[model samples]
Target: MSWLQLKIDTTKAQAPVLEELLETLGAAAVLMEDSADQPLLEPPPGATPLWDATRVIGIFTVDSEMDAIIEFLEAQLGEQLPAHRVEVLEDKDWVRAWMDHYHPMRFGDRLWVVPSWTPPPQPDAVNLLLDPGLAFGTGTHPTTALCMEWLDSLDLQGKTVIDYGCGSGILAVAALLLGAKEAWCVDNDPQALTATRNNAEHNGVGERVHVFMPDDMPDMQADVIVANILAGPLAMLAPVMAAHSHASTHIALSGIIRPQVDELREVYGEWFDMDGLAIKEDWCRLSGTRRA
Candidate 1:
């Protein structure tokens, strides 16, 4: 099926607001990319990080009835935005575009986020396959790396873990591989549940990994909670995730930019005494133990 790939070009400053505005329209997928960040740039000797001056956000899968889409966005910020600003591009290969580029990637030591089409890592890494459809959680992103790295450092022996928003079941499957006794993964998307199930079986942990739909959790507290969701959900879930802990339970959180560390910390600070944190490429991972 063909999808409409609408490129709403805005200044770096106007991009976020526009992107958020597009969400109220009909965006199946939305993303912001820096125009100045050259895809063709080469590494340089002791060079400064590249600065992005322009912003491009893509909104996908709209119908011929984009009048509503246009009206909704324009209604809110029509005067502020550039005239004739919405440029709709046709996506002839939307599926292939994501599949071709979103390949398996390694997040940290002994952990491999293998894509569905790619062959598993050769011989030595802890392999975790993923199929990220519309949902989230692939280990290639730095936020996922932070959580995986935190999981790598811990001794998951005999622990029961909960992976909230278990997109692809990456964390839950990894927990079992890292020696957790068992894991339960929860997601609202049936597609994600299916992928999680498939990935668990692929990783040889299906028998040990239980998949649950949202609001249907098994009512048992876990020894560890790993949430790789965005900051908004992570903060909203702070109490619920913490509730999954007693005294000795561990927590690993990611999907937050470095600038927002303090907000996430404040959410879980009183409940957990932080163990340590990892920073890589502007993403942060935080882990802690729930206090008694």
Candidate 2:
């Protein structure tokens, strides 16, 4: 079955209305993206921020009435339609097409993030079977990769790990596969917690992995802690992270850019003996050990 993809360029303020209108007009799916190369910074908690210049695309069946939909949209907005175009999308195995672009990506020497459909290039390596999903973290982003690499370097055997802001539970699962005895995965989003649990089960570490929301996280110090979230949250959560660490407990923080390093270091440095910064592209990762 072919699809009709209608693309409309508009401001972020108007994108939502357009999206809802298209959905009401029998659109199967809607996707909104940055029309301009604008950098979106960390949004406030529970906010789904969009770029100033947005491009909203609505997908409908090939037989859908494009003219009627446009007329309705224009009528609703009380003005002429914005810059827009329609294209025919040929049907194919989209999952396979997406999977083809992602092969096994090695983080450090032994840690590899492989898609579930593909076999690991090196069977001896500690392979993490993950795919792109509703939640984040597949070792593709620089922040996630840095955390995974740090995990790979550690001798996690018999140690307890805490993956705060755990998305997809990649870090916790990696720690377990790297020989950690147990892992605690925490996230604010329910979907993230669900994804974490599912990923842990898929990686054969469900029995050893625990998932929780921030408010409900139990009081337990971990041997190692990793938080791959934005710099702002990392700074704010320093006290919480410190509470979950004891003397000499290893910690790694990422999702930071270059300019935000000093402030975060100052915040976390109050409890952790800061280590050298790791940089990949424009992203940065910070690691340290907790002080007594």
Alpha carbon lDDT at 227, candidate 2:
93
Off by over 4 Å in 2: 1-91
lDDT per residue as tens, model 2, 42-62: 232234456678888888889
TM-score of each: 0.62, 0.72
How high is the CA lDDT of each candidate model? Answer: 0.70, 0.85
Model 1 residue 114 CA deviation in Å: 3.2
**lDDT per residue as tens, model 1, 45-69:** 1122122344444456545455666
Give the best candidate by lDDT: 2
Q: Residue 271 of candidate 1: its Cα lDDT?
A: 87
